[model samples]
Target: MSRRPVHSVRSVTAAAAALAAVGALTAAATPASAHAPVHPRAARHVLLLSVDGLHQADLAWYIARHPHSALARLAGGGVEYTHARTTNPSDSFPGMVGQLTGGDPGTTGVYYDDTYSSALLPAGTTKCAGVKPGAEVDLTEDLDKNQDSLDAGQGLSGLPGSILQMTGNPTTLLDPAKLPVDPKTCRPVYPHSYLRVNTVFEVARTAGLRTAWSDKHAAYDILNGPSGKGIQDLFTPEINSKAVGYAAGADWTKDNAGTEQYDGYKVRAVLNEIDGYDHSRTHKVGTPAVFGMNFQSVSTAQKLPASDGLTGGYQAKGVPGPLLAKNLDFVDQQVGALLTELRTRHLADSTTVILSAKHGQSPTDPTALNRIDDGPLLDGLNAAWKAAHPGAGDLVAHAVDDDAMLIWLTDRSQAAADFAKAYLLARSGTGNGIDGKARPFTASGLQTLYAGTAAARYFHARPGDDRVPDLVGVTQYGVVYTGGKGKIAEHGGAHADDLDVPLVVSGAAAPHGVRVDSPVRTTQIAPTILRLLGLDPRSLDAVRIEHTRTLPAR
Candidate 1:
């Protein structure tokens, strides 16, 4: 939010015309690469994008069919990795952090967006002052001052049509009172402070390059990394807020059309950034050295159920249905718009465009869905623990359950975890096992369970680590721990379908039409971004801590 002023711009139209003229001059004066004369090998700029829930197979399927689409064009001029995997338990928080920090949950100490840390106090705990040092870290729309409004309580009521109309720093939109309190200092822990490592934005900023980013929630303030000054222009328009131009019942992720409108706001922001203006287009902040935004339309389409005769989710494995296909097309067009804008501004050749995903949706085949509510299961476990111990309150302090389950217990002892593990495994089988209802995992849904030391080791953390969960559950490929009827697919699992996402690196020093069949992780993106900008990858704290290498080149 701290920034310097730039030349005044009359209007959006004037800014576009001015940029076009400048582009004409730049094209005539210099080579395609903006800094070719000074730095021939390094790209002057890097455009990073994350298309959430875009699987590796989905990219291949789309490019194979739509040969002229934006994705296919990027693949044609880019190096596509066929087996690019995202972080395990692919929740958006750690998944995006992995790409921006060059580290996984193990090294970053970020397991999921909504997680528990025994070292932090509850939200609104003024002066922790003997208060318990344990609380759920919620990094979602719940942090918004008004989660129900697109403005996030930044302005008056009834203002609609676009989140861009909401002004001020994205971080300011989050009410500090809603954040978890740091017991040590009795201070609120903002999302940027919650991150344990530095990001590519921080590294680039340290190198005196301007940086920018756009994401769904203000909690993406995490992208700023530990320094809290990584991205100069951080644009976060709350996606979970009420949909613009729609009834109060409609939300962005609830419907495919609403999600498209939400994504369009970000696309416009990116276009504005491409035109050398801030995300809001009110000021000319100049183009950033590293900048991008994520697309949520595709992810929403892959999860939302059929409504108003519009169907979602995949028809079969690696095959998209009509609604999903339309959303994919919408994302493709947005990518094309960004690419076209880059070319129009004479920045394409000088820019390194990297397109990938934070996470992928599970059970691409809609019929594979198994909706089992983990809420009842947790309650049953608590009851079982109470019956066994006579009186222990509740064993679980918090449990974040999606397709996977990360459990934090009030009692972090190994014996307690063993008991919970046994209870869950026993109820995993068919028949009435818990709460006089059918077993939660009746269809062999639970594939793997890690508890106590096993859970600690899986995350490369010591037992009793404050941030590590006491138990981790990896469900079967088709299992999604949701009893809701609005969705057929979900993410945040260890399944191949959840972690295997697309990775495409295009333009400026990238090999064209080359497909790297080797396995790679999205964590490599941070180092690769720094490398593209001629910055040392080791400059990033996470890259150094994790020994992360730059993405492979053919």
Candidate 2:
């Protein structure tokens, strides 16, 4: 059952040199003496899994209650970081990228999937000759060729290959017409091009190691980094697509059960990869050196309301409701299956399993819920701006809001930003504006507002940076910018519940059942993976630029 290692010391050295020639690695990034392999036999393959929305508290609670669960087993036989944190504004796109690139939004140039870029032209704008460069860069299913189809409009002619099947490259699933165009080149920008930093997959593949991954959206093709060919076996099943064996309007994340079904698709893909096959189970490619997928069940369970009259989210801090508990068990069972396959294939001792979450849900305590409608809030601001300056049009270009509000203004002038901020602060109390209705914003929850240079600096960018927002509204912990009854909690904020996630590093070489209390970032996962694989961690561009280090040794 044993096989040769996918990458040898000599091959990695040659590959690193080749990568340096292509500028993926710089001579100064990695010292010459660091090329020597360390812990080569401890980890030949790394299996990384992101269980989205699993908070550190949730992990502790689950491990205490379900001691025999796979997650508990991994923690027992591994090093657990009790103070692990994801990136601020912890959305899936940047959160996952943080782990793969060893950089935050500032260095990665990826803030949110549906974020605004002031330096890009609108999609389908044929003439960028003299047009103003600004557009909403949608990297979600909206960019899919067929947003409603499971295969992203890759028409099916046969059975057993319609869903999660790629006829061509993953980028093909993204409709070019729907992508933002670079005003400089007048060409559509793909997901890979949108990323400013390289990923772990890029480094691994460049070092002659096989790489594969499965995720919820085709947009995750961004993980391919600048080269756009990092992952050899990339399977992206659109989670928002119409669910099979369910109603026509039902998508995977609509409910807990459907999300489990969606996660199961990726689980199967991982199992196939573990068995020395490609993600599709139709190709007999050798086991990948780096491969894994993300589970959406936990996230879905935390957001959607349960049918048994119990709302979603935690009953108390670090506690789970009935539905959430069920999904946790489901994720545990899936991990157990992966471990079983690894043992059966005799790759257990040689493989390192790194389990963590992309982000955590906020308002874990159901009593702290404060849902507000953001539409009226934005409309009021725009109306106030228009009233102040006649024929000025709308002041807001676009606004992405969850628990926090990121506003990109049509005019990035300081005067405009100051005016908006003043107007918002003046009307913080319950009052009617141009909307002629009671204001949704309360003085208590919507107190913190960053404008213009302040907002840019918050994201580590200079004033007027194309990607940085003009105004950022940070809500109180209990406040979620939504007027929906379906969801009780949400992510994408700087709160402890949103950024504090679980990080467990498990392998034969890792210390057993040791808990590290020091604060660690998800961005550390990239360089750590390279270290586990006996490669130069600094070879990754983001790691070099950010000076990211490997996980702390036990």
Candidate 3:
């Protein structure tokens, strides 16, 4: 990640502390709006903005410090959910899936980035009829049938057992060999592959609403392999390989003219689409009714060198920092531009703007800040366990993200499962700087770990999923997962910081300056958007929480 470097540690820390203090004071003093007008007619256009890793608290802080921010301006004129929460294990994939599908892991079947594959292809089959490895299979019908069984823990071994029986095809599971390879390393890349479920774009398109999407990740655009029928146009910096004037082989950089700033490019694309519709460049009516985009530069900036100054350039600038702030500001400016266009074209009153995020980013623990390397903890554990067990099945330990480690035992035996758990517990605190070391668990241990918790409400296992991870390891707060450089920051855990995020609704068609304080989950986003658009949430099995009250029943 290319970012402006910060050179002063002492100054940076002091400045950040000061800024945080001031921000706290400002939040306490600021008065929230008491009431707002609500519009209820079906909206003509819906603009959805997704900012990666945006925290509601951070947003409030940004507004308090920089009242002129686009975010602040929008908030002042819109409704913000003060107490919003995301789904458990709030990782990017699940968060986004929740927004688009309005279903939690239980309903959507997207539990993690690397879930248990149920595909049963013939031996030696590398690809699925030319489809990329790790591609999503259509499991909607199967999921529906086995929902009850899965919830009952009939098949939780993370294998292709019962699910395969339901699907009737053993090779329909996820196969690593089918995952998209990195051009340089020949390894599977992020996102694994496109989703298998019907997303929001598809729903919108089916309703005759034109749509467009701009995201930083290629998988967002590369849905299930190529033909982007759900989305009319997809613009991503990572996949803008064929954009005119773009360097043929250069990597992502500022100099690459074709690679417009992620947010800026998306805003411009949205504005262009609106303009084209207004000028008759495209069909005036039945044109794109929804526009969605993502900005990732802020995440990139966090990984860059801190600037040399009090609070470091990154810390002093705010949560997103200067670079990201500038981009977000630009996004806001473009939002203003779109609003102006809507009003000028007499469309403002009919359009609804919904802003949200995929997940929130937790800052690196200052005490253990620059570590990004994962030691040979897994290897050592496996070596020791294997020496004792002799001919046990292969133990696969994968560091999924910064917070969780998944262990898969290839051989399905009671002895292997018992040994695996004991070994993990013994070596849990061996290498990681975490105070709470890894521990092995039996079926009973899971209950103890989540004693008297809401998490237990949603905990269910399927064949393949349950057996794959006989033992799971968790990192305590401030101890993020490391790949090599040491320990840095990451997500994919069951913590409030990782699961809580902001949900804001702003625009002429929405209720302005109203705040909703309730416990909400990502599964509600899809249904909420649908409801706002005058559609029925029950169509997708998304239950409307009691806290979701429409603006005056307009």
Estimate the Cα RMSD of every predicted model relative to the unseen true structure.
Answer: 9.9, 7.8, 14.5
- Please, what are the lDDT tens digits per residue for candidate 2 over residues 1-554? 01122322233234333212112222235562353443343578999999999998999999999998899999998878787888867899999999998988878888887899989999998888889888999989998887666666676544224454553256778888999999888999999999998888888887788999998778888999999999998888788887766667877787678788888878988998999998877888999989999999999889876733445667776689888988889999999999999999999988889999999888787666677777767788899989889988999998888877788999999888888787766654442222233444464256588899988778777677788888877777666776556677788887888888999888755767766665678888887787777777776777777787667633
TM-score of each: 0.90, 0.90, 0.65
Q: TM-score order of candidates, best first?
A: 2, 1, 3
Query: Candidate 1, TM-score vs. the true structure?
Result: 0.90
Give per-candidate clash totals: 0, 0, 49
Off by over 4 Å in 2: 1-41, 157-164, 307-311, 428-441
**Tens-digit lDDT track of model 3 for 1-554:** 01123332233223222212112011111111211112132566677777666667767766787787667767766657665666545666667766766655554455555544323222234434543322222222122212222212233354222211121111222233444343334444323233434555565665666666665443443322112366665543332222223345432332212223334555655665666442113334343666666654444334333211212113432344554455445445666676777678676676667777777654433333323233455575567767877885345433344555444444434566566555544443322322233323222111112211112233333444421233344445444556442223456655455556777767644555655553444555664555455444443422322222222101
Per residue, candidate 1 scores C-alpha lDDT tens digits across 1-554 of 01123222232233222212112011122221222222223688999999999998888888888999999999899778777889876999999999998888878889998999999999998966889788989999999888877666687555555456565357888888989999878999999999888788887776678888888888888998887888898887778887766656677787778788888888898899899998878889899999999999889888877643677788877789888888788888999999999999999998889999999998887656667877778999999999999867999999988888889999998999999998887775332211224543542257778899999988777677899999998887677776555567788888888888999889876767866665678998886776677656666667666677676654
Instruction: Give the Å error, residue 470, model 2.
Output: 1.3
- Collision pairs in model 1: none
**Consecutive 10-residue window with the lowest summed lDDT within model 2:** 18-27
